[model samples]
Target: MPRAVTLIRSTALSDVAEYAYAATAPADARLIFLAGACPLNEDGSTAAVGDYAGQAAKAVENMRTALGAAGAGLDDVISTRVLVASARQEDLVTAWKVVRNAFGDHDVPSTLLGVTVLGYADQLVEIEGVAAVLDS
Candidate 1:
């Protein structure tokens, strides 16, 4: 069996998200599209308020849960899209740190965007991912 890898590249966007991603897998392979995940707790309440680090952590955790639901893990994640409410340099840096820490040794192709706002007024960050199920 052959494994597929995600591709990342520098883009014209801000320094935070220069990496662009594409899905490249066998035609017969199974692919999963995860919905946009926000920094919300299990109880459907916002996890962090005005805390970039905390919101980032929760967003990453939510991404992990989404991947698991698709029968995949962080290692199987091919691409990720991160949305940050604040475009401040400091906030971007802090969010990146949280994401990098969550991935640890597994680094997948990712894109980070600085947005003016998110779905929830308290949400500071949102994360979405794509994964591929391994062949049995």
Candidate 2:
């Protein structure tokens, strides 16, 4: 099936960023707005306490599960916002690297943020995403 999401790259924009600068989907495509995927285990405990990259990976896994339930995949994602609990740029970069690797060549438009805290205890990362998919 043809993908509904299209990642946009701008030559005018510096190529330093790991992800695309923008993305768009056709009007008829079904849009899936996912809640922030947290680094929580199935038992309600935090998956990776005090570990930025680990938490980010867990969040990405949860995000994938949510997207699958909504009939979409990572490739269908048009944009993402990654929230990391830290004042350090290195911490945010660690989380961003995990997410960027997960998306591979898809490289959806993304925003990485550093926040003071997250909802769950020991939760260091959360990922919110928007995906577009066409119904058969």
Give the best candidate by TM-score: 2
Alpha carbon lDDT of each predicted model: 0.76, 0.95
Task: Give the winner by lDDT.
Answer: 2
- Give the C-alpha miss distance for residue 66 in model 1, angstroms: 1.5
> Relative to the unseen true structure, what is the C-alpha lDDT of residue 113 in candidate 2, on a scale of 0 to 100?
98
Mark the regions of model 2 whose C-alpha exceeds 4 Å error after superposition. Answer: none
Provide TM-scores for the models.
Answer: 0.81, 0.98
lDDT comparing candidate 2 with the true structure: 0.95
Q: What is the lDDT of residue 130 in candidate 2?
A: 96
lDDT of 2 by residue, 7-97 (tens): 8999999999999999999999999999999998888899979999999999999999999999999999999999999999999999999
